[model samples]
Target: MQTQLAVAAYIIHNNKVLLIHHQKLDLWLPVGGHIDQNETPDDALLREIREEVNLEVEILNKLDLPVEGKTKKNLALPFYTNVHSVGDHDHACFYYVCKVINPEKININQKEIKNFDWFTKEELNQKHISENVRNQALEAFKLFEKLTK
Candidate 1:
């Protein structure tokens, strides 16, 4: 089976997480998509967010690695990683938590998303949300809270 690399971000603002109802999948999920060729994970993540929600996000997770000799840039590390089946293929997904730079500037791509909303911690526990997404979103919320404090 073919497995493609993908990146996702849980964008948090004002103690709420941004979720998009994907048109094709018909499921509410974090903003993300397949990592394109020649694009780094960080680039793909930012691009996906822009295409999906038109919001710039600041990744909450950071690698403290020293940049001395060769490369001076350090990409944010993923908070979680998993492989999940999608139709006949699979997605090797890297999960990240982020903070929306401008919450009021959102403009969802209507073709890719059915709707978008912000969910609080209590709202994430609703039965309508998929179990996997709920758990991951909760974790992202916790991480974001800890980082900000």
Candidate 2:
């Protein structure tokens, strides 16, 4: 199975996580896409968020380790990583928890996303949200709390 590198973000605002109903795949998922050639994961994630929802986000992660030499920059760490099936292909996805920077500016790309909604941790238990997505969303909340506090 071919696996392509991808990035995803669980955007948090007002104690809720945003999820999109993918038009093509017919699944509710976090906003993200494959990393472009020669582009860093951070760049890909930012670009994906911009293109998908037309909003800015702040990745909530504990970047910058004790060892600093030779490192030009410390990229935001993913809260989770996994290889998941995407029909004919698989995506090795890096997942991050992000805080919404511009809450009012959101325009979903209708071509890729059918609809979007912000779900609280309690609301994520609804049957329509997939198990995988629910778990990720919950974990994102934990990571956001741990990192931002």
Candidate 3:
């Protein structure tokens, strides 16, 4: 398995979490992507945010996840958690908590993302959004609240 590093950013505003409807995966996920060969996870996340959401943010915290296990659809994840390993590809992703500096203006990546929305925790819980997505949003929100306070 080829090992690779990636990063994800959770951006929250007005008691709502920013989520993207991924075009390829056909699922809702936090904004993130693979880290480039020379880029740090932080750098990769910042670049991904700018590319995917057209916004800058301040990294609030670093979330460490050990790389192991196969991908599982945990009811408590935005995307499938656990490391991914295939024929020639393997990856472990780091998740980060960040606050969008500007929420009013966003440029969604049309190619990979179908739409973007800010959903309140309750609304998200009640919506048709996936259970995994809601769980991840809540986890990210809890982290945000704890760090910002």
Candidate 4:
């Protein structure tokens, strides 16, 4: 089975979360992508945020997920268990809480996504978001709320 390494971020601000409407999946998801061969998960995540949102973020380490073992550092991340889907390339995602650190306007690339939006938790929970994304958005929001409170 092929493995893929990836990193994701739950960008939060004022009880709102940023999500992208994926063109392929037709679902909203946090920003993320495959990790390059020479970079760390943190680096890959930051790069993905820049590519996806056109903004710089300050990653807060407090709410980040546990990293995979050091032995698997350079190994391909398995997607079977890391995500909701299996048989596809496996991936290990590093989820972090982040805030926009710069004031640049967003310029989303239309090739990978349809649109982007910032939604409150209330709107997300009551809307038609995918099950996986809904759960993730809720969890990320909960963690973020905890940190601020």
Highest-TM-score candidate = 1
TM-score per prediction, in order, is 0.96, 0.94, 0.78, 0.77
Q: Rank the candidates by TM-score, best first.
A: 1, 2, 3, 4
Clashing pairs for model 4 are 78-90, 78-91, 79-90, 79-91
Q: What is the TM-score (0 to 1) of candidate 3?
A: 0.78
Best by lDDT: 1
Segments in model 4 whose C-alpha atoms lie over 4 Å from true places? 62-81, 86-88
lDDT of 1 by residue, 13-131 (tens): 99899999999889999999999999999999999999999999898788878998899689998989999987878999999999999889999999999999999989998887899
> For model 3, what is the alpha-carbon lDDT of residue 83?
69
Instruction: At residue 116, give the lDDT of candidate 3.
Output: 87
* lDDT for 80 (candidate 2): 96
Q: Rate the local accuracy (lDDT) of all candidates.
A: 0.94, 0.93, 0.76, 0.72
Instruction: Give me the displacement of residue 82 in model 3, in angstroms.
Output: 3.9
Instruction: Count the clashes in each prediction.
Output: 0, 0, 0, 4
Which candidate, 2 or 3, would have the higher lDDT against the true structure? 2
For residues 2-53, what per-residue lDDT tens digits would candidate 3 score against the true structure?
7777777779887888888888877777898888986766678889999999
How well is each residue in 1-149 modelled by candidate 4, as lDDT tens digits?
Answer: 67676777778876788888877767788888888998987678778888887878776543334567664433222111254342466666656777776635677868887998888987787565777777777877776676567
Compared with the true structure, model 2 gives a TM-score of 0.94
